[model samples]
Target: MYGFEIEGGFTFYKFRDFDGSLSLSDDHLKWFWEKMGKAGQISVVFYDGSVESFEDFKKLAKLKDQHFFLGFKDGRPAGMFWLNGFTQRSCFVHLTIIPDFHGKAALQMGRGVLRHLLSVTDVSGSYILDCVKGLIPVMNSLACRMAQRSGFEKAGVIQKAVYLAAEDKSVDAAIFCAVRNNEVKVSE
Candidate 1:
């Protein structure tokens, strides 16, 4: 894992701040919110098409779950990503790689993060990833593909669930579940 390298000749450093409150500051929070608007890696649309304040980000970060932030070589806040429902059984994520590092070494950091999430986090059964059908770029990342390569199948699509973002706009989303439990598989 230490020998892994990314496209821009940069190596990934694991940020252990799972609580998401360590490196964050007023300025950094503001930066995350501002950057969210132009972040191409994110598919979910924001209420105002802009993340102009850190309050919203802080709230999101406050969720009691496992989170990870990937940093670049120069350490200039390349990207911010995290996961929810992180438990010994399974975990989920709302990831974004930030636009600037879309095709650079920062992407490697994102992949590494996902790999860590899968390897370290004990998904009691197997790691499950939920993604929207329209967000192909995200679903096609190395992490998701790796899960498929590992024999994780498309369990099913989440049919019911209306996500209400800011402004009370309910959004429709699809969910994908993967179970790596041999016992469950054999039972089925």
Candidate 2:
């Protein structure tokens, strides 16, 4: 039961019962978008502003500085995790789990993906997560809490940094970051 205690003393366990795996190539794009669509039901308002049509998602997926991964549970598509701003020293981490697996399972998937990203990948320095300040109860707020629990510290706020399509405008964003070094004890 590989796990870590996050804020609120909640323990997120890594799912071992299923054949969980992560695909880093574009081969899983179709399956990845399918899960993204389902996860968007909860995540759209917080981050994406609106659900991306399959065609639109395809285009976004091809954008520069973005890397996508599809996580499988029992050999089935279960979640999506991606890194943005990868060309720079710091990158953005984003994740979503399908609606069916929202609680412990989702956290488990997130932990697994994050663990892989921080440990096995060369993309290191600091990882940033920006959340819209207004979408508190919906997205950014929860993410802020989670970031702290996961050992990320509040960096600062970037005014009008994010554009919410739903509002068709820009909004303030709070940034959180996790820096990796030999001294940082990142849970495995």
Q: Whose lDDT is greatest here?
A: 2
**Alpha-carbon deviation at 13 in model 2, angstroms:** 20
Q: List the candidates' TM-scores in order.
A: 0.55, 0.63
Task: Score candidate 1 by TM-score against the native.
Answer: 0.55
- Tell me the tens digit of each residue's lDDT in model 1 across 1-188: 12233445444333335333354445555565566655632334333334334565666555555454544455555655555564555655545555566553444554454444444422475444322121112324453443333234444444324433343544433343444333111101
What's the lDDT of the predicted structure labeled candidate 1? Answer: 0.44
Per-residue lDDT tens digits of candidate 2, residues 1-188? 33334232233333221233322334456666666565554345335444456666555555554455555565566665556655344567766556666656655665455444455432474443222111222236655555444445566777887777777777787676555442333332
Superposition TM-score, candidate 2 onto the true structure:
0.63
